[model samples]
Target: MVDSSKTHEPLLVARGITRLFGNAYALSDASIALCRHEICGLLGANGAGKSTLSRIVCGHLPASSGEILFKGAPLTAGSARDALRSGIALVAQETSLAPDMSVLENIFLPSYALPGRLSFSQLRHKARAILSELGHDHALPLDIEVRRLSTAQRQLVEIAKALALNADLVIFDEPTASLSPLEVDRLFDIMGRLKSSGKALAFVSHRLEEVFAITDRVTILREGKTVAEGVPTAGLTQADVIRHMVGRDIGNVYRKAVSPAVTNEQAVALEVTGLHAPPIVRDVSFTVRKGEILGLGGLVGAGRSESAEAIFGLRHRSGGRVLVGGKEIAPNSPIAAIRAGLGMVAEDRRTQNIVPDMTVGENLFLAQMGKHRGFGRGHSARRKQAHELISRLGLPTDRMDANLLHFSGGMQQKVVIARWLLIEPEVLILDEPTKGVDIGTRQTIYELLREVAERGIAVVVISSDFEELLGLCERIVVVSDGYTIADLPTSRLSEESLTLLAAPRSSAERNAAFLRDLVAGHGGTAFWGLIDEDRFVCLAVAESARSAPMGLAAGHVYLAHETAIPLALGRRQPGHVTESDGRSTVLTPLSNRRGHDLGWIGLSLPAGSKLPNAETLSARVAGLFDTPQDEKIDA
Candidate 1:
């Protein structure tokens, strides 16, 4: 037992939590504490014992040998009743609600087993009241069955159920994984309210941004043990957290794809015209240029994957025309797509991409059996291919013959990518290519994608990452509400711009098309582009401490780096740019002799900016002088 004499005794505590199955260790000596009114983030790649630890904590699974304590009192593991009675509630990735039961019943299901007779009328009143308190008035019907609710509504029902349990410690497992931004904001509001009410919460999510936004402290687990714990969110970056989790630095997630030179004889790789998939994908038309990396950007359920499936013939299309190299191709069948020189890396890799029980070698070559003389006899060749892929993808070579299920989620995702590569298709569709992969493995996958694109393969990538689109794609097609709203050049894409595009718009806003065009036009500007907080630097430099937009049009508030003085300045601030080579240059707001405040002019006289440049940026900045002194500023 911990020294309870400490004033901040944890509401819930785990000590030496260990769970193992046969020879495979799942959770080993894992322990963490949750304090009242605190939100702790539990982070790790998939299969890093996050779920296992959560299960042990919530009493869903027995700790092989360990103890769970509630308010410093000894508690039993693997007892659902004990956990509920002890005020520990868990909302898993899969919402737990009776499909046929009303939302009211779902929220009060835990307390229904009490000694008193069930009262449906009273329960409905309480459920409605709770929903109202959670800011869901009339949004979710109390009497409506859970099966009819949207994914976000169902998630709220789960949260409401947890809240109704009066749980001291509530665990949310990827609650926003599939939610829209508005839904996510609503959920966060609910969480914030819960925190204010002195309740403890644990949020487990794959999104680093959400973790930073919602969590107070973070605990990162790796390979079954807590590698880092109680790490504060302050002064720490996403790359820092990912480095601790994956044991490597991966701040540089973006990579420029070198365009392959197209010969006049080269054929058009992929063509789709008026493709219509009812209810999910609407009339969409686009062409995948030969050897080009085309990116599809959208929110979840925006039909990015559905379009990919239609292209790959996995899902039925109501109406569409597809052409491979100018030759008309039939649809509604995956085999036809494969035959037409196309391959797909699916979104849900666990179920859709890989055969878990199969060995890595078998999974890699599963789609291409014709290349082998026989199935069993092809092991040697398959092994060679698997070894090559494993090496190329930085996978563990010794685990080539091992069951794919035994590999980590990151490694499994890599295997999924490798499986598709064996087909050597002319056009490849990768949906959420790095879904659950860690930073290091994600880089390897990006490199692999580049290699494939270099080989004259028309790559169509569907990603939820706006930054990724800006990085890997020459152009991005934004999808929303089953419609292709805009096709934007990679030159005009940013995280903020993509967010605005992915979000749903009002009918009037939709018809205007001004926001979309504005985003597409000005998204590529380098605002807030200088700061790289991943590295340790005690110093920051600014020249005159005045601001005007550098690459943007609007002005913003400014602050002195040393004194932290507040000042209202334009978007582009006056600053002395300094490089690591000790060369100091200055940027002064240039106006004509009339002092009309023409855009700022930078001189390579002495220094660089306060932000450090890790790359060989001196030469790049040296050419900035050649740029026109006055560029038309956007309003």
Candidate 2:
């Protein structure tokens, strides 16, 4: 992974890059620098030319006028071949996949351009290893056509393609858009590995939190110009980055309702009971109250989209009870679901939601076209509703007849959500609503969803972004292996805690088994949780000694002073600490081999129970990290 050029200078530098498409400028004076062993974040709003700059650097497009130095040598403009040969690889935002090509073939597509003896067997093995490392051991089928894959699956292929190159300088452009928190962690680990191996990385993303988390320095773009160049990311705040990207201050768009129209106790607008769809979905159940934004949170391919499809009637469900306003509705067809007051913006927009040949207005009222299939067409009323919605949503009234594909991905998603709102359904479900959208548009959509709930419409949002779920929703239902395992309020959750809650059942089970073994060896309750400051978030707990019966449960957050074992929680040292009430405890910190904080594992015993050695407990806890994640206790 080391670059042969052992210079102390930056590995790659693009100075005053400018590109023009006809009379308009796509980029102007945009500059960025990527250094070896460091990740430089390339940031901008939706149309801010970050992608344009990345393409130019990777030789996907010819720079109208600019200078790029790779390993202190000038890079040939607009020559993808030359760039690849020079060890520059880009995982593009808009994928470059051949529809008919298999996943294996598509991953190594860059290789076919070079002269070499083909070894399909070696490439296949490498591809499998890459996918496995990406946490998709059996999810993506190598033989399947790229066209048949989901958006998230296709994104994995994009990542694999770049990794296959083993390039010296890698550019990750919106690489985590479709990946969940769990999967993103895996990808970040790989990035860390590359950085450690002395390779350079340029990470292009709109996610500010991610930018701060993974980047060492940042380059900000505004209106195709570099506003901030090579600034230490740690020294810059989120506000500073936003101002640079948008040329103005942007407040938090994830604003909660000051006075909500409805509460979780008010009324259930959408309820799915014992939902069962073969294969992907086993059993999923949740209830969304009027005016509540409920999040469906989980890892990618953990049956979240499948659960949504099953509930919306897009996928056939073998068993499930759908209820709207206390009345049972059948999961027969999408039209039936719509008629029963359900609206859904599916995950796949191009295939499942949009019609490329139709005008934006036509597609906006597409649902209306179906609901009134046999009845008299109410053209006048439909037009009135469309106009009002357009004004409210700030839609393009001037270009109503324009093709839907003419809009950017962000605008297109906004239009899709608007269409569902036009029908005024009681329940509206959006799957990965912010997927592939930039930061500014993401904020707008968050506001839109908040507004939707304010109007007394129940909102169910499925997303891979853990922070989005915590910010936008009041409650989150965690799905793993197609089952709704934990239902908890957002107040008690953090991105770290939610990740733990959404872990796959097998991993969770292993952790739980480890806890059980600890309880069997000792005479007390064993629990796993994150202990930060005064807040203690429990992820899993197993009790074998009912005499102790610590009222602690999973998916709950407790303050240090409020718990029965307050002394033990407060101490949180490497040894056992006994409380005033004589309840003894042993605590140990746990983390994976990668040095990720997995939180603390503790054992609590009744007043007179013999305490085990602290070192012994630590050794047992270490085993949890060595194996798969332990079970998430049912909330």
Candidate 3:
């Protein structure tokens, strides 16, 4: 499906690229080419050399051996500054912005390194123009400090910075990981504009859907080697891409079928009620049963990680009750939480979990040492168990003496997971466990967690990857604006529904107000939800006190037959359908400007109450999606 004429020339070419880290080859003979007027996808699993090639091209790291050509000339960039001077820029996955600097200063920081008189007013004007081109002119301010912005906002700054350089080739690494659907669309629009302007682009990401949507061609890597090069995206399927990335056809990467049975009869391994940590976590509550995997899912900065920290005593709790094994533990005491059989793998493994100075074996026993009361690095007590775990995790015992930093990111993550398993705690919590890990390693981690759950250890996983959450966990607890908004079975949820449920409370205020208006004007109950076959996933609900009860509540899933008004829900017609109980219900489909399905809005009224015209109600629901961003209803 590749366009033969477009493949004739390349703006940049890399051949036989190889990078070494200590005794291992991070990249081996990896080669790729990016043509002008095209966006090439750099596709690979973690540690598969995608970032290695990108870094070498951007001059952040020197290639051990390779030949690179820019504009048909031999190119050697001694440093990042040299690469920028050559019209190349990389927007890294981990941002490189200075936290203390304002947005305007950070965007023009690269310019400061060059020998030229700087003008603050000109730089601000240029930054504004770049942001406006990316469709985020109003979202980011010029004077605000970078440290105060959320992850997504900071990413926008990174993109705008790259544009300010006027680079012909821009490399974006996991650029959309923190963006919402709307933001993603705007980014794509910018990419389209860049492509039409005859600029070459390299998009490095693990999200295959984005690659298929944006890239003209893809180059896949596995085991530090190029598996597929210059493969046309139009001809490839998801299964084919997965096969190339992991070296095998993986069926259902979540491996949910391997999960153990979890029932109400099982004991609650961890219970958090009314948890509060000012400025982040607020009034969060959930329970995980023994042998079950519970997911904490929400947008970035929604306090999912903060809630986990509060329960594990890593954060000071203003109010909350944490119980492990049916016994309440002291608030804000990590030792008490550990004694009560609770373990946590924090969000940032390098800073929070790993001890880089220690050997791998010693790092594996670090948590066990913390729990030991006898002192003197009590590693001998769990030495045998540690060896067994290491063997099961496929880690080489001979390399146990090596520095923990020498291993790959996936191996380091396994070591961290093994650290907690050494304690044999009844409850385990992992935040973003698979972040920066490869797809194959992710599958292995999934299987390992399933095995741990089967051993009766309750597991709680907090992730920004909604698809991973739905695939790995039995149930999901949605947090929005620092509150546990919904808890539902994974079977009843999808990525789209989860996004709607996880919308910030401020962003969702308009829909809430519209529902309230519907109930107050019609004397009925109004709700918003997604319908999948015979099931309904309710996101929000509002009812008038004078209205009859509909036996439905927010944050709950139900079968079509289980509700009092099954007929109306099953039909989902535009007009009102009356049930045997003399209640009339109407369902109207909701969609955004891009025609993405937001789900349906419903209203149920008692028999005697006058029903609003179906067309008028549908128009009102449509208005919610069509409203301008600046004119949205505030909370």
- Which candidate gets the maximum lDDT versus the true structure? 3
Candidate 2 per-residue lDDT, tens place, 1-635, comes to: 00123234798888879999777687988888788998888888766788889889988899888898988888874588789989999998877888799999999998999997879999999998888778775678899999877678888999999999999999999899878877887899899999999999999887788889999888888778888888888788998888777767768868765874455478889888899988878889999999899999998767899888888788888998989888887775888889889899998777788888999988888877666656776456778778877766657788899888756576688778878887889999999888777677788788878887888889999998988999999899999888887888888788888887777776566667788887888768999888877778877899984565788887677888878888878877878888898888889998776667778888888888998889987886776555432212221
Query: In candidate 3, how many Å is residue 541 off?
Result: 2.5
Over the full model, what C-alpha lDDT does candidate 3 score relative to the true structure? 0.84
Give me the runs in candidate 3 sitting further than 4 Å from their true place: 1-8, 99-108, 114-166, 176-197, 257-260, 625-627, 630-635
Tens-place lDDT digits, model 3, residues 1-635? 12233574898999899999987999998988989899999888777888889989999999999899999998889899999999999988768999999999999989989997998888888887788666566557899899877665778899888978889999998787666454566689888888889999999877777899999999898878888888889989989888888878877676555344799999998889999998778889999999999999887667888888889888899998888998999878888888789999987666678989999998998888778887487788788888889888878888989999887677898999999999999999999888667667788889889988999999999887888898899999999889999998898888877877787776667777788998888878998888878888777789999866787877778999999779988997788889998988888897766566777888888887778888998888877756556222211
Which numbered prediction scores highest in TM-score against the true structure? 3
lDDT of 2: 0.82
Q: How would the candidate models be sorted by lDDT, starting from the highest?
A: 3, 2, 1
RMSD of each: 13.1, 4.4, 3.5
lDDT of 2 at 225: 88
Q: Cα deviation in Å at residue 221, candidate 2?
A: 3.1
Q: Looking at candidate 1, what is the lDDT of residue 100?
A: 96
Q: Given candidate 1, what's the lDDT at residue 452?
A: 83
- Give the whole-model CA lDDT for all candidates, comma-separated: 0.66, 0.82, 0.84
* Tens digit per residue, CA lDDT, model 1, 235-254: 56998788777877766666
